[model samples]
Target: MSELDALRERVVALERENDELRTPKRRRIRGRSVIGAVLLVLAVVLAPVAAMGTWARLQLVETESFVATFAPLASDPDVQDFVAEQVSAAIDEQVDVSAVVGEVFDGIRSLGLPPRADTALTLLEGPAADGAISLIDGVVHDVVRSEQFADIWTQSLRFTHDRATAILQNAPGTAVQLSDDGAVTIELGVVIERVKQAMSERGIGLADVIPEIDRSIPIAQADSLALVRTVYQVADIGGFWLPWLVVALVVAGVLLMRDRPRAVLWSSAAIALVFLLLSAGLGIGRGVFLRAVSPEIMSAAAATALFEQLTSLLAGTIAAIALIGVLAAMWAWLAGSSRAAAGFRGLVDSGFSAVRGAAERRGLTTGAFGRGIDRFRGPIFIAAVVVVTVLLIASRPVSFGSVIGAGVGLLVVAVLVELLRRPSEPKEMDVDPSADAATSTAQDPVSAPDAVS
Candidate 1:
């Protein structure tokens, strides 16, 4: 047999002999315990949610501008076409760009203008104006639904369109269209038609028309600084609770897996605290960046600005968290899996070992990427204590009871995690049956008498 095959065979024989040393039934029981352990984990995860009924609303409860904010994302034609089979499930009232196409036709008819466009306004805006078709629809809805002036506004809408078109036609540099390369075209028709179409379908009417008409409101003014700030604040507030819920859920999952009840309860609480600090740091960083960058612009209405900022920040945060956690977990796995390490070394000819040695020399090596470092544990513990002390000194500015409960709960969890973490199993002996046979022969030095017989 090849050397590799012989080595594998020897390893298997040793393992089987080792198995014989322990009762087979004990291993079988351990295998069964793993399945029971999984179910236990799921139960622990759901427990916190059950206890906090209303408090749990912090997790999935829609944000204040949820519909307005997300409406644009939901109405992408690409997304619509992709889900065409399920399009029937979408309510008709859902204002996709398709829905607004009819409105644009109506607006053209009202203006007594040709339906032909000099150039596509949407094309001019390109991807920048995506999902904003719904924002136009929203303004239309607001104008169309106004209880006091809806009728008057609807009657004047056509006249208002003509006037707005005229105003744009007269404005310098604003009337020229852009080329496919995003260059400005000399043709006024291209620019005018684009603005007319977006406005007409949007149902701008009296309420929304005046602001866009103010020539002083430059294109740059649309940046919406205040909105970014408000979004950051609202997100920060919601963020405070979000981490706690996530932590509780994760702890429950881990404990259920380990089948350690006491550990699960305590660990869940500790996880929540870590989540809080992480969330806060994220929120503060986001809020500061959005606010300090631009203070001059209105950024649209205050709430809209905030919602957009929050959405952008949240997207970035989620992606970062997912990527970093996966990489860290992979590093930890590589550090722990020596068998896998051996296989890797075989293929790479000790390249990884050399790199590790270099890293160790430079003080860049960690015992294991995630194992030894109390990253979440130490930072969270210190932060929690500081937050509590600050809150207490401020005459209980916040709910001390909740904070204390959460902190204590997390401490208990950290302790439980340390306790439940399984130690490395003792390595099996690399025994060969041949070796045993040879040893037996040597012990019976008087085997010469048996040979003579």
Candidate 2:
């Protein structure tokens, strides 16, 4: 056993020696460079992702956009109904109508003047309960429709948008607030307090419960409270620097590569993959988020609509990033050895040449104008692509349709420009009469020297 252990140790030592002898001194440095290059590529790829996340958070938290996002909800029956239900539930928790009705029935039993009193109380129970429900619902409806309610809704939605998950994190204060650890909650308090006042005026006894209730409902939360903190941490940390750091790493990697174009192609492909993951991850997250908050608590449709709207910017940014990466990789590949890219380039060049030849035949290529057109044809086509891309980006929503439309539109513009750019050139064709006559005479037997002799 001792001999075997010694043999194993000697073998390990020999392998170590062999590795050092086989490896160049610079090999370690090369490995480090490769690792650094990879890290840089990741940084570059992640820059856009971080940018997307930051933009999403800003849209969700910013006042104007947040208001605009939910303003339409005021008119949406489904959304209004959802809000009414939440407020109604809150009121229910504060005012126990069932207990109130039970007490009235017990009082009739204590009176015991007649069996009719007990029976009368029994009949009143249903209508009384219905009347109470309708009154509270009316109060809620009035609150939901009022200008005051809209103001409250906007503030509450904005607050919830920013900090709904945080209180679940035990961050302090009510579930909804303007800032972390702030005591002031942007709850349905205004709406609820108003409803309580109205209900009190109607001689209902639930005004006291309204002030005592301080728990504001959250629009979003996670399974574990810790996860809610994790979200805030990630959003805060990744907000500005994560993407920039990624961009720096990618730039470093590309700069370090022996062949930059290939590096760009690979890096772009990697970026596309990352954005693809981001896009898919967003989808998966939507499901996870939906699972955490139930339809029983909030309307599933409204929740879905809200989630979709909030993440729309992120989705668009991801798609745009993916598209740009794909286009860059395609260009790099074309600049290298892709058959399709070569064919595309060939087709464009051939079109330009054909157009120039046709113009020349028509005497339109007789001057510097035509020469200039030929010289600038490539730039003109590229310029058209740039213009079209700008237009696509300027569009309100850059959908797949817009991308396809831009591609087709740019292709058409390039073809038309190549064909029609030099139409104003003169059509004069110059012919050499002396060469024509010499060629004709040489072909004639009578004009040939041997034939003449």
Candidate 3:
């Protein structure tokens, strides 16, 4: 009985040991799982922030490089200081990207138009080809007063295409005018013909007149103000946002077929930004407009009066139209599945049908005359209406009531043009129903295993 009791005690002791070992193993597994989950959560939370930080760093770096490279070309002390401040602010993380850009443009505004006199000339006595003595003067004069003389004199100079283009771009307020002497005009014509012949031999023409920098200077002086102007001009006239705009438009078009809501939002924003940037860049290049809200900064006062006068017209007319186009595109996107498109098509068809019914009911329909009138009358009437409207308004005495009436009339006209006018129907071949589906397939391709039995 004592031996039996000893065996039972031994078995119980072994069972207890086994339980202790199993408990620690289970605890270890639970700890490992908890650690893995924590690591996964950390990666998920930090990855996007890290990526954003990297992107911001890259942009900041690029902006810094540009600043450093173009530091010398800053003419205004205010601009230089502003640039420096922006750089410092960026480094300190005190301002956002948009704020930085605003500051830079504000600096640009500080660099206003060059001073002009009634007639200004800077003489250049330089070496001439073929051992011929040559004299050149960079001239700037008012278009009204000097137009005739400058025009004739320009022909007399027989300036090469390159030279002429250079004069046009750099010499602000320069205009070509007819010479006082008919004899001078004749001689100038002969000289120009000879130059044209020479240029033709060299495979050049008026169309080839691209303004380039004077590359004959020393390398150190290569980055001078003269060279910088060329850079700025090229950057300006090269359709500043053409490539980006096309890319955005294509992307938006592709996205339009899939996620229209997102596409409209993005595309509208991109178009608005591109237009504003291009306009502002052009204005800067041409030294046309500048802004000032502070007494210390008097840039707006010095900008071309002509530009200021035209600003209201430009902003109200052309800019407004572009903005409207963007809004329309966005609104169409908001109505997905081409429902907006169908609505527009129906609207156009309804208008034309109404017009046709009206003509039929009048019993005034003739074959050729009616068809011709139907085709041409709209445009002709529109043109006549526009002219008469303008003349009538202009002829009327100016008053607050007249101006208000004109504004109301104009608004009504615009609304009618947009909503009531019948647009030509688009051919069915223009849109491919399968393209959007194909694009989706391309983006997320079908697997061979999925297709297999």
Candidate 4:
């Protein structure tokens, strides 16, 4: 009984030791999971911020990109009409055609006209003012719609890019000014000058009396200029580095996970969701912007055109990122050990096998070349994916079309590789009868002795 008790105690001690040994490992695994979860969440949360930052950086830091983005707004009919209306209003306000017409009538009356003639001339004042306003409106519309105006628009944007950057940075700017009310105004004084020139060329004497007008037209407005500035500053500061940081976080998080493929799938899906929300948020923001901008400041159509044009690049970037995330998630799922993934892979393999077999039946075998490719098939496919990924990343201003094109190209390459690969022939096994009999004798010693007898 004493010996049995001692034995039982020994067994208990061993069990306790085993539990102690596993406890630390379990704790470490839990800690890693927690850390990885935190990192993945941070990455998903920062993806939209990184995207916006990249856009802000590109628009503010690269003058050429900024010009390219907004230069086309010049040709938009709504924009042209807006400019025409604003310039015509400015000219009418400054020139005072009614007052000018009245003065002309008064001058004629002062030239010794009879009472009846003076009364008739006074009656013509209203018609004269209306005709002069109509003439100014027509000339302004013509100038705003002309090709010369588009050239001037592009040049003005290029020249004002720096000042625009400064304004967004919360610094003083003259050519492009941000008002206290969050109105972004660009000096249309240049457009006014063009109008004056056009009117003069049309042989209108009143154009000489149109004094140089300095007017600024509101292009965009925000709810709070300070908020806009703050956002701009943050985006500019993080633009170049934030995207890379998000990538690093996501990679680190995936590596730390025990189920790396599942982690990649979840993380990429989360990223896609975030970007989709961002795209939706942009759509919602357009509505809010149109509502907030009063008609007195800018017409709805004009504001809508401006908002869409300015955000087109940002929209494209968001779409591209979301698409990449979706692709990555699909890749992760396909590479996983799940039943669906396995079934899909099997289907693809069988299809490829059938194609290869049909080709071989037609004497299209690649012989040794096909076998060699089969040996390196996995690495070749991985290289193709890597090349497409690199090209997608290196392409400036990545768009949906480019991403889809690269994906299609990769699929084609993968299909070609699969078709080109040929399995090597199996080697025949050499049978050794004596060796097999010796092994059987070792397994059945009794049977071996009976055979010897």
Runs in model 1 lying further than 4 Å from the true structure: 1-307, 332-342, 345-453
lDDT of 3: 0.37
Query: Which of the predicted structures, 1 or 2, would earn the higher lDDT when compared with the native?
Result: 2
Segments in model 3 whose C-alpha atoms lie over 4 Å from true places: 1-148, 152-161, 164-222, 225-252, 259-266, 277-324, 327-453
For model 1, what is the C-alpha lDDT against the true structure? Answer: 0.39
List model 4 lDDT by residue over 1-453, tens digit each. 664354445556666887888788543567787798899999999989888888887876778888888889889999899889888888878888888888888888889998888788888889998999899899999999999999988887776666666777656535557566666566789998888888889898788888888888666556887876776677677887787788778878987888888998999999989999999999999999888874866789988988898899889989988998898899899989999999999999999999999999999998899998999987887688667756755564668888889878878887888899998779998979986765555455445555434
Q: Order of all candidates by lDDT, from best down to worst?
A: 4, 2, 1, 3
Top TM-score hit: 4
Q: Candidate 3 vs candidate 4: which has greater TM-score?
A: 4
Q: Which candidate is the best by lDDT?
A: 4
**Alpha-carbon error at 115 in model 4, in Å?**
4.4
TM-score of each: 0.25, 0.59, 0.26, 0.80
Q: What do the candidate models score in CA lDDT, each in turn?
A: 0.39, 0.66, 0.37, 0.82
Candidate 2 segments whose C-alpha is farther than 4 A from its true place: 1-40, 43-45, 56-61, 68-79, 96-122, 138-151, 158-186, 193-215, 220-261, 295-303, 359-453
Q: Cα RMSD (Å) per model?
A: 22.4, 16.4, 28.7, 7.1
Q: How would you encode candidate 1's per-residue C-alpha lDDT over 193-221 as one tens digit per residue?
A: 33334456656432232222211111112
Q: How far does residue 124 in candidate 4 sit from its true spot (Å)? A: 1.5
**Compared to the true structure, candidate 4 yields what TM-score?**
0.80
In terms of lDDT, the poorest run of 10 residues in model 1 is: 213-222
- For model 3, residues 1-453, the per-residue Cα lDDT tens digits are 564354455555666877888786533434544443443333333322322232222222233322322222233334323323332222224223334334444555556634442112111111211111110011111211233433433333333322333442566655653222211111223322333344355553321232221111011112344554454354444322332333333333533333544444544455455545545654674463344322232333323332333232333322432353365355545445677666875786587667756765776345555455545654754564455345432332223344345446644654444333333445766656676543343333233123221
- Quick one: how many clashes does candidate 3 have? 7
Better of 2 and 3 by TM-score: 2
